[model samples]
Target: MKKFDVDSKEVPIDILSDYILKNPEKIYGIHHNKMEELVGSVFKEHYNCEVHHVGMSGDGGKDLILIESDKSIVVQVKRRQSRSKTETASCVRDLIGATLLNGSRDCIFVSTADHFSKQSIKHKEDALAMEIIDSFELFDIDKFMGVLNLHTSEREKLWKELIEIK
Candidate 1:
């Protein structure tokens, strides 16, 4: 494995992809709770927000809650890598329910799928303050590729922690 230093840098997507492909199943097949933590970490790092993992046994409604300026952004992470249109719709509906239950207006559904069906997208758009982050946008990969800079050492530590998390 390569080590990263403390200078702000962008780790190439190809390199990260290659690393993921090395043990695709293990990395991708992590449990839902672990996935929530990974997603929360990504958001926390990218948005400079306080993220709390609330998705264990009795997670009120959301998997994580992102606190930013007196606003609580409820997040639900679905590990379903693929789902039909109806299933996607169902997931959105669930997110809506979670939002209402948690009394949070801002909500986000993060998934490891490329995209949701058109109907699902429309449904989410129609809902109140709902945002979907599909697989491609799941980790702000593009932002990471474009401008987001992280100390190489921090990035390395994050990568190591992600992969090593059971």
Candidate 2:
């Protein structure tokens, strides 16, 4: 088995993917805050944005904030225990509210679940149509891995990482 420092400031996605394949349990067993950190790091690296982890009590619905020039994006992260569990509409609603309250123009809801409930997708579309939010994005485990540009093999490991927990 191979090992890499999960606590490192900048862990390359490929290396992290390799490590996850070798130790799926280790990645799946990370604390919620650590999962937020990992997600933040990926966004920072992939989008060249500054990420702030606001994962704590009374976070006001956002776990991470991404800043790119004049634009700031609020993000809510859901680390579900099971991939079969679907993220609900309320999560999207909370993120939308948080983005508006935070004075940001965009929001993203990230989840480890295999998918978001149809109601969640509808809520996001409704918010967009009403111009309640400038933009909203939902990222499941697959989309999360896509953002990191993980190869198919690496992406499979992520799915396995979630599955092993079940």
Candidate 3:
């Protein structure tokens, strides 16, 4: 199994997923807290802007955060591992309808998944005024393995995945 930066406290998946599955009605209540932080971190690095994660009710997500500067950004996060395009697109659709993202600078969909479709990117460019980035860009291997000496978590996982991709 692959390891993640245990440096960060994990959002409880079992409780969150179960709550989502059981009370599909109350999912926003359960995951908003955890999702916002992850998006805030991603936005800081990717967008280079100050963003906030607000857990607004009826936001239709686990994490609802805003990244703002000269212009505001609305982000909807899906904290799942790699999934099919259908699943990814679903999150995109919800963010659009919320109008929370409208008139804001940009709309973003953040995921733990390692992949996305070209069609998704095209739609993002053409229709949504958004962008889609995957885990690969977020977690590159060489920089991570640079700190490795002997079986380090970053070195081991990062190097192996980098080699496999090449």
Candidate number achieving the greatest TM-score relative to the actual structure:
2
Tens-digit per-residue lDDT, 70-95, candidate 2: 89999998877667779888888788
| Model 1 worst lDDT window (10 residues) | 133-142
Model 1, 1-166: lDDT tens digits are: 7653212134343343334345343333455665676567667876679998888776755899889888888887765543321236776777777777776777777765546666667666666333332211222222322222343346778889999996
Off by over 4 Å in 3: 1-32, 45-48, 61-64, 81-86, 99-102, 128-166
Q: Would you give me the overall lDDT of model 1? A: 0.58
> Candidate 2 regions off by >4 Å?
1-18, 21-27, 149-166
The backbone clash count of each candidate, in order, is 0, 0, 2
TM-score of each: 0.61, 0.77, 0.46
Name the candidate, 2 or 3, with the larger TM-score value: 2
Q: Against the correct fold, how does model 3 do in TM-score?
A: 0.46
Among all windows of ten consecutive residues in candidate 3, which has the lowest summed lDDT? 133-142
Residue pairs with colliding backbones in model 2 are none
Best candidate, lDDT: 2
User: Which digits, one per residue and each the tens of the lDDT, describe model 3 over residues 1-166?
Assistant: 5442222346454333333344433323434345456446434644567766665666554244455456655666554422332334445545555434354434656554445456554545544333331111211122212212122333347779999999
Stronger candidate by lDDT (1 vs 2): 2
